[model samples]
Target: MNINDLPAEMLIEIFTYLPEWDFLRNARHVCQIWKLISTSPILRQNVELSKYMDSYAYPLKYFSAIQLYIKKLVMHSTYIQTFEKHHQDVKFENLKSLHITSKVQCTWWPNSVFNNFFSMFPNVQIIKITPEFWRDAENCLYALSQFSIIELDFGYYGSNSFGTMGKLHDLHYRFIQFVQCQRSLKILKIRASDHFAEDTVAQILEKCPTLTSLNISGAYVSAESFKISTNALALTEFYMKSQSEFKDGDLEALTKRAPCLKTLNIEGCRSITERGFRHIALNCSHLKKLFIGELDSNCVTDVGSDVITKIAKACPHLEFLSAIGCSKLEDDCIIDLTSSCGSLRGINLNGCTNITDVSFFALADHCPLLNVCEVRNSAISLKCAMYLIQHCKGLTKLNMSNCNNIDDKNDSELENMLETQSRNNKPRTNSSVNSKLDMSSFSMHCFHSHLKDLDLSESMHVTRTLATKLTRILPDLISLKLSISADIESDEEWFQEIFENCVCLSEFKLSTTTIQRQDYLKL
Candidate 1:
């Protein structure tokens, strides 16, 4: 059947499959029949498009192709003026998302200029305004409150005057009062200069009862005195980073209040203690992931252990736990963890230096279903780590960083699965059915094919041959952390070769002082 013969609904279905920009452009060019169907009010209600403009070759040709796919477009400072060069008969009503950020800061942008910029898209529902231009058009933000916005990322990049207590208070109060109170604001991301305004945040949560995701990263949460009692009944995800103000009882009270929280991350909240963790484990039963780092020394003691142990027993569904830098943990506490919460899927014991090989073996014996383990800085040698890996066949991710004993030989046998092409030759099939796979041997690359992420940082004995073997065998390797190592320097070229061949890598970290950014960026 011809395109014109299809029904509006069928055409929309086809068009929706096309990206936002392409769909709009394709619809506009078709006969009036297709245009009407594609441009109908119904089709425009829920769709969003983001068109990118970068300084590559063929600006005109690129813009033409992009204009066809452009639903919402972002223009950097350099590209803003150039967009008009490729201007066509496109309507402002067709656009849905717009972001304008520049490298150079603008002092002042008049209200008319700002209005005209957004006037291009009357149906805008998502907007991101950077601090680079916030000063120029602070009042422009007041106009944004009118849109049907559901997602907003507002940045305020000003000089750091967060030293004095009085200055911080005033800065906090000003922005808190300035945030446009929108009932429809469901996802809000803000970068503040000083501590987050507890009262203001509370007000925001109270107003937006439907808010599901909140990210307040790199901010001092002075809500120490201001109790964080969430009114966001629909809130599911909350991330608070660098919460320097989360002293002692603050986090404990906050978690107790957020009973329905599914994901709570207070990364770098140094003030949080065992009391806070205990509070969360007890109250937030639905928490799927909890990342509490930089706990105080006192809280890592026996008192903290008792609280967390109770929490582990109470919260039966805890899956991912990142208690990094909690040095108070001993084998006893780990034993309690395995016994109490046997259902754990992933655990990160990055800086729990007290944990030995014995502690991990205990975990391996108890938590058979554990798929991922990150024990970066502990007493577990390559020998004990290999044992744990052999037992936990289901594991795909492992971390043995700072464990000085993880030599090249010890690493190979830990994960040594074979990856072979299927009958079709195009597809690869991995098998654990081989009988010759020795579990008793202490080899580093024992089950290599099944291994996805491996951290052997500070394992000084790692050589070029071992690194190459790892990359060749482990086709699914996603992350490899080998920082502060002696072997990395000896075979720098081999390191490069491995990274180049490991096509599936998404995250990587190296601590060599000599490696350049271009070298790592090749991955």
Candidate 2:
């Protein structure tokens, strides 16, 4: 199939995957037809001015062509000239998403600039604003309410002129009024620590019932007064962290309101108890991701896990579960979890010392889809580790760092099997199985081979010989996290073996605790 003979639609689709500048500079210059497809408004919908901030890599006329197709304008003060009103009549007809941010503060953008910016994109559906830019939020809110905004991320870093009770109330009233007006609003993220906006947030939730995801972790949420009587069935993801207000009953009530929730993270709620966990396990049966890790104390102990199995039984579709430092859990609770939630992909049981080899046996027997398993500081032994590797063939990540019983004997066998595979065939590459992988980010992409990610950091029994052997075998290793082995405390030869054999590694995290100073120099 000649490249020139390919249909225009296919060529356009291929061009969309190329980097923005590469498309304009290389692919577009291929031919006249390619240039037309490259400059299409659909392809240029997400217009970011940040790349053009540092240097004038392209001509002014090139940007003029881009201005016509630009739909989502991302502005940074560093790139202020890129968004200037040179083409005042440019109607930005397809504009939907607008974000203005500054990593380094320049002169505060006045309300006049805000008014002009809003006027330019009258059809925006997404707005990400550094709230400090708006001198008077009331007028800006009124203008935003008139637009068809469905998502808003407000990072408010202005002076607290609303510190006084009366001014704060008026500000809250305006924000709630704006929230109510946006009938199609679905995602809202607010970042302002001062002025606990519990009542205002409650009012917004009550008014904009269509909101699906709400993140207010950057703001203080008054849990004492916040109540939700009406069920927002559409709301699925909610996060409110670092708060003392979430009592046992509040989360259960919130879950009852948003029963279809898929992801819920209340990691900073200090007052949450076993009852709240039980409520979530019972009510939110559709939950796919749940995070209930606490900082101050263990919220869900053994007693909680007993009731939390209701989650495993009810939500068998659960994919990700994290309950760090919840040590009261025993083997049966984990057994119930592995037996019920067979679709579980990743689980973190760090600091859960009560669990033994029986849990691993259950995981090996039931969970075939499991990929990542972290059981740091657990009681899993070498025999059980071998059993797990034998059964769970699909596991790409297994972190047994503090499971001190995991010695070099069984892992030596893995090294042998890997050597056998490598000796029989060409070195494994990502292209071998790229179709099943997610290539959105190079780092996130899997190596597409057996045992892509491995961590044996704290397991002191990993000998220098086995380490070198495994490196030669696992040719497609994308990540290898390791600690200095007890016997091979500082072997530069062992480290060299990895670089020599594992050419495909993209991430290598090491802890050089036991390496001698001179040994480090040798490395």
Candidate 3:
């Protein structure tokens, strides 16, 4: 097929997948036809007028040319001055969505900025307001009355500290009063607020009938905080994190409330245990993604793993499961999970110390389609890792960092050998060894041929030889992470040599080591 023979529609579809419109920056100058397509209104529909646009003198004048094409416009802090001046005149009549984000301080915006900002996009369907554009409660209430927004993301920007002032309740009430009138709101994500509308949940239920995903994670909402009406029972994905009063029965009760909820992320509820999660598995069997990980503490014990086993058996469609810091999960739990959930795709068992080689064997025997697996800071040895590499050939991302027991051993040579190879008494061949004495050829040559992202950081086992042996065989490796393990002898050249051999290495990280940024330039 000739390069220029493809139709314009097909070419436009291909261009949409290209990385950040880089090709068009110069390709527009290639030919008249290309330039016309590049500058067309259809291509410039979702334009972002960010701080980088300051590089141009008159961004407003530039945007005015494509006013008819403006569908989604993102305005950052840099465009604030020019925005405030000519926003009323800049007419994007067909604008459907508007995104406003900034990392500037709470007091950065002029009191009238948001009021004026909303007036500019009065009829936009979707409005995303980052926490940076905060105004006084009085100004906020009057300014937002114009927008009939369907999707609203009024959340945090890590800037505002919702202080524990004497008027805390007043602040909550004011917030509710401001947003309660948004009857057409469909999706609401409120972040970094300790109090999620103790009294306003009913008002929201009344106002927003089509609410689907409610992320009150930053609100610090408790089991007792919400007074959800029956009208608000249509939520699909509900995420509530960092609750002080979250108890064990919340899930059992929550399933009854949001019966159709597909994804649940109750992350930091210290009071929740296996009992509630079991109920979640039994009742909310339609769950696709469950994140009940106790990030700060190892609160989700074997009971939680047991509940997960129930979830695997009951909810076979569970795609992504994260149990980070659930330390008590042993090999049997993994066995049950792998056996029951043939659909298991990605699992994060980081910080689970009780898991070992047994889970690896079970996963290898079952779960052929499993792709992303992270077992960092676990008791799994490198010998079992040999089984994983050879058996779980489909895995794209594998993280076994901090498995200190995985010392520089070629046990994987025999450990990972196929059953047929062992019966014939044939040793694994290492034909492509550049130099027999090369330290890179120390570890077993080629095992995980399909792995793209590998993290062996903090494992004293991956010495100079093992790193070389591992890198030589893993031809598909794109991103690699390595850290200096204790007592492992290595020089700067060894590190350089390992990287030089990886012709496809795209993302590299060498942490807690003497490797300098300049060494990367050498490769």
Candidate 4:
């Protein structure tokens, strides 16, 4: 059908699928009718309109003409001066989001520049400034008191041990005071230099009473050292990472404080023990997604398994759980989880050595819809893996890195099984049905043929022969990661042959000593 013949609504639906507005420019050139439709107010308000305008312009083009039109503008050190030169015509009025990463020299200037730009944009809602622009940030915060800014992301670029200094203590105090006074800020993400003091965080939380989402990933805030004020009762999502800073009793304290939290992630918090996890489960009963990482063997042996098992029992509504590197977590805990939490959909247990392949097989047996299983650095044998491949058909992503037991020997056994199955399916009169089935080809098929993504990195025993064989077996494989494996006997020839054979493969990683990057690049 001609472009003009298609209904306008249907055309709009087609246009929605295109990520950039620039597609409309080409669409306009198609005909006069399309040009008129493309310029409509509705089309001009395309969600990704800025992306369209950006495609044709240099990083620093006529700043004034494009300034007001830009919805989300990210300014690195190079383009900061460009925007500063056209500072007046460069209206931040239409800018819904602004991210400025300036150099040390441009700090003072960017602040005054934004002070002018932001004052005109009454609709300015989200502002993110790099640490280089912190001085400018404080100025903008002070100047744009009228702005209804809802989201603020401040990167770490401060001086004088910016992470640990008490300079932010004053800013926290003022920010909280602003939160109490102002009405628009609902999401606050602050990446302090290193670690923040408890009093500083408390001050900020107390002021931002309406805050629903808070992420302090880079900031070194131990559960013991940092405390959220009671005002954080409204919070629905909280992310805290304190793996580098080891302070006792912090996890327990933090969980107890944030009772209303529905999505809690305490990744790399090594000090968090069973007591801390229990405290979290007891307090945050509403939590639907929990991420607990960096767990040591001792913690898992002591109470880590029990902590997670009990959480599964308590949080019946939990949908996603990522407890990677918790080496002590065993098969029984997983069995208990699948039995208790029927709502669980995705679980990532990478580096949980105590879990064998049976853990995955059992999880598949119990959980009807397990989609993702990442069991890297475990000792799961080939038997359980085959069981998982057969049983967990719903799985999309499977990581069996370091499971070298799944080699040619295992393939031989699977071929034997397929041979037996094929023999049983043979008919007396129609022996041709047996030939049509291609039992020899069935012997070559891997147990998991439907897998789209497979990561077998660091499996030292895996050879090029087995890798190539497996790729052919799983024809639908899209992403394959086989890093740090044993080198191919004839590297150059083997790689070229493998790449040519694996037609469906898109993302391939064969780095480390097993395969040089340059050698792989040659393919």
Candidate 5:
């Protein structure tokens, strides 16, 4: 069959996967059939105006065909500035999602431009204002209050300049007014800098009864913030990360109000201890995803294994858990959690230096659905890798960066042992050797075909031989990250071989510790 002989429905479905720029710039101009299919409502559902802002020299009719069918629109400051000049007649009645990206700080827009810009999208329900986009919080909040926004995301960069306490108070008042206008607000993500006080959040919780997801970061949340008169019956997902003032009492109060919480992220909140986590395990049994990683502070030493084991027993339905830099965790905690929570799909145990191969063994034996595993800066060895490859058939993304135990010597030893065992057909002397042989045999045959993303960065012992073997085994890799050390002989040949084998690879990140001029040129 010819390539273009497919039905229109199939063609539209294929074209729908293309990016907004590709579909508008290249795919639509291919042939008459493609052009007709490109004009379909499904293809024109998302219209990004920022990409076409540079082509303002084009006629007004160039965008008129897709304007009416656009359900989501993305614009930038440059596009909004010239919107009145170039596309004044463009109106999208069906637009429901409006994303505004800004590079330079915009304080305020002229009344005429602001009115015309917002009047075009009458039914916008989701508004995403990116970081450093607006400096004047009052103007931004007042303008947004005019629309009945259901989901509003004010990016992490709160206001660049709230010069005085009075101005910050005014911005907070304006934000509360904006939340008051949102009668059906379901999701609200805001960077709570100086703009949100305890009273402000309490008022918002009291007003927005339909709110299900609330993400407030970048500020100190007092224990009294979640203390309100009415119960948050509809709240399900709450993320209060990096709040220095958020303590165990705050978590307990919030859990009492939001009893139906499912996904919670309290990472970087150094004040939250094991007591805070116990509150979650007791109140929020339906939780599926939890992130308690401490990214920044070095003094965070309260998180231990006992509380995590309690959480595992309480929240057995947890699917994803991230405990990055939680150095207090040992093998027993991971073993208990993995054995208890059989449905776990992804786990990040980065910087848990005490975790050894025992945790991986438990993961392989208990968690069959494990797909994404990150064990950076740990004490795992090649035996653990072999076990995961042999058992976890669904494993796709694995990160073993900075793991000093997985080196060229261990790889070579394992290969030699397997080769000798195959030649002699003899029973292994020890149980560990027998287990290694079994896993090695399975790994040799299976080749881990499901893996697409692999990272072995900062492991100085990774040599070319192991890299080639991995590239050949996981041929469908989309992202591969490696770090070069002084011991590796040649970098060019292995990189070329990797590129040839992994045909679907798109992102390749390479770093080197020892930089020689000749090696640099070869790379």
Candidate 6:
């Protein structure tokens, strides 16, 4: 059969797996059949023009081909100028979502520029503008108010300076006006320095009755400011990160109103203590993903095991939890958490040095569906690693960096097997040595094929022999990191053997103390 004899549906399905840029630049130009399949409505439903924005004239050519079929468009600032010069009258009637990103500030453009640009997409329901577009806040907000966008995500990177207090107040007033204009608003995310006042949050909750997701970061939200008159019944996801003024009282008030919240991220909110979590347990029983990591904070002593015990008991459906840098957490809390929340798939306990092997054992005993586990800089021992490998069969990604107890001795079983095989392969005399087999030529079975990403960086006991055994045990690794303490001399052949054994490996990091030779650098 000829290569082109395949059905058109099959060809289209194959082309769907290719990257958008590759389909546009290479696959579409192959033949008329391929071109027609590539430009089909299915392939052109979501178009990303940011890659071609680097060249001034390239995006205009591709835009002409897929403009009518594009339901979602993502373009950079340079494409705005290209469109204005060439295709201003082009109407994207099917476009529902539009994402605009700018490398530099868009202060030079006036409100009329955005108004005219947005007029082309008459049916756009979702608009996401990066922070650089907010440098000219008054004009941008004024232009956005003209349209009734259902979802607005003013990107998380906030302005470094909001000018004077008077200007900030004016900007806040204009922002509120913009929110009031959107009658069907459902999702809103904004990260501006002190941009949302106490009443502003209350006003949004009361006015946008259909709002379901609200993310306000880099702002000061106190209990008084976050207070609302009625319940936010439709709200399900609330994220208020890095709000230093947000205390337990504010969390209590907010969770009381937004009782249906399933995903909450209050990371870096140092003022929120165990009392805040107690409120979450009482009100938000449907919580699934919680990120309360106090990254780099020295004052997280208040969030101890009591907080985790309450959350684990209340929220049994919790799947993902991140408590990074919470130094006060111990093994008891984790044991209680994993034992209760059997549905947990990912947990980040990085920098919690007090947690010992007890937590890992608990995870292995209860959380069979665990996938991603990070315990970097912790006190976990070899038993924890062995238990996780033996019990958690579905585990994929594991980060054990700076874990001093994990050394080459963890692979003692495999080492013994290798020594036995070597003795059997040895030649009886010097004449038969020519037929002797190398260790790398042995066909070792893989113990764990599901694990794709493994990090053992800064582990002092990782020798060349142990690393070679790891390649055989986990042959399907996509990313592997090893910081071996052994010398690097005459190790080029071993590295080549690793690449040959782990055929699917794409990213590998190896570091040693001794200086590497010139030939070893090539591998």
- Model 2 clash tally, residue pairs: 0
The residue pairs in collision within model 3 are: 193-219, 440-468
Model 1, span 266-293: residue lDDT tens: 7676666666667777678887777776
Report lDDT per candidate. Answer: 0.61, 0.67, 0.65, 0.62, 0.73, 0.74
Q: Estimate, for each residue in 150-231, the C-alpha lDDT of model 4 and write its tens digit.
A: 9887665566554535655655555555556656677888777653445556656666667788887566554434443432
Q: Which of 2 and 5 is ahead in TM-score?
A: 5
Put down candidate 5 lDDT per residue, 158-273, tens digits, no spaces: 55364555666666677778888788799998764554555777777887888999988665455677765646557888887777878888888888888888898988888887
Q: What is the TM-score of each candidate against the true structure?
A: 0.68, 0.77, 0.77, 0.74, 0.84, 0.84
Q: Candidate 4, 319: how far from true, in Å? A: 2.4
Model 6 lDDT per residue over 410-469, tens place: 666566554654455542221212212222343331145567788888876767777788
Task: Encode model 2's per-residue lDDT on 320-381: one tens digit a residue.
Answer: 88777678777888899888898888888877778899988898889877888888777887
| Ten contiguous residues with the weakest lDDT in model 6 | 427-436
Off by over 4 Å in 1: 1-77, 80-104, 160-181, 195-198, 224-232, 295-303, 339-343, 362-372, 387-396, 408-448, 463-475, 478-523
Residue 85 in candidate 5 has what lDDT? Answer: 60
Q: How close to the true structure is residue 55 of candidate 5, measured as C-alpha lDDT?
A: 66
Question: After best superposition, candidate 6 residue 469: deviation in angstroms?
Answer: 1.9
Best by lDDT: 6
Q: Report per-prediction Cα RMSD to one decimal.
A: 8.5, 6.6, 7.0, 7.5, 6.4, 7.2
lDDT of 3 by residue, 156-178 (tens): 43323455343445655666765
Q: How far off is residue 131 in model 2, in Å?
A: 2.2
Flag the better candidate by TM-score, 1 or 6. Answer: 6
Lowest lDDT block of 10, candidate 3: 430-439
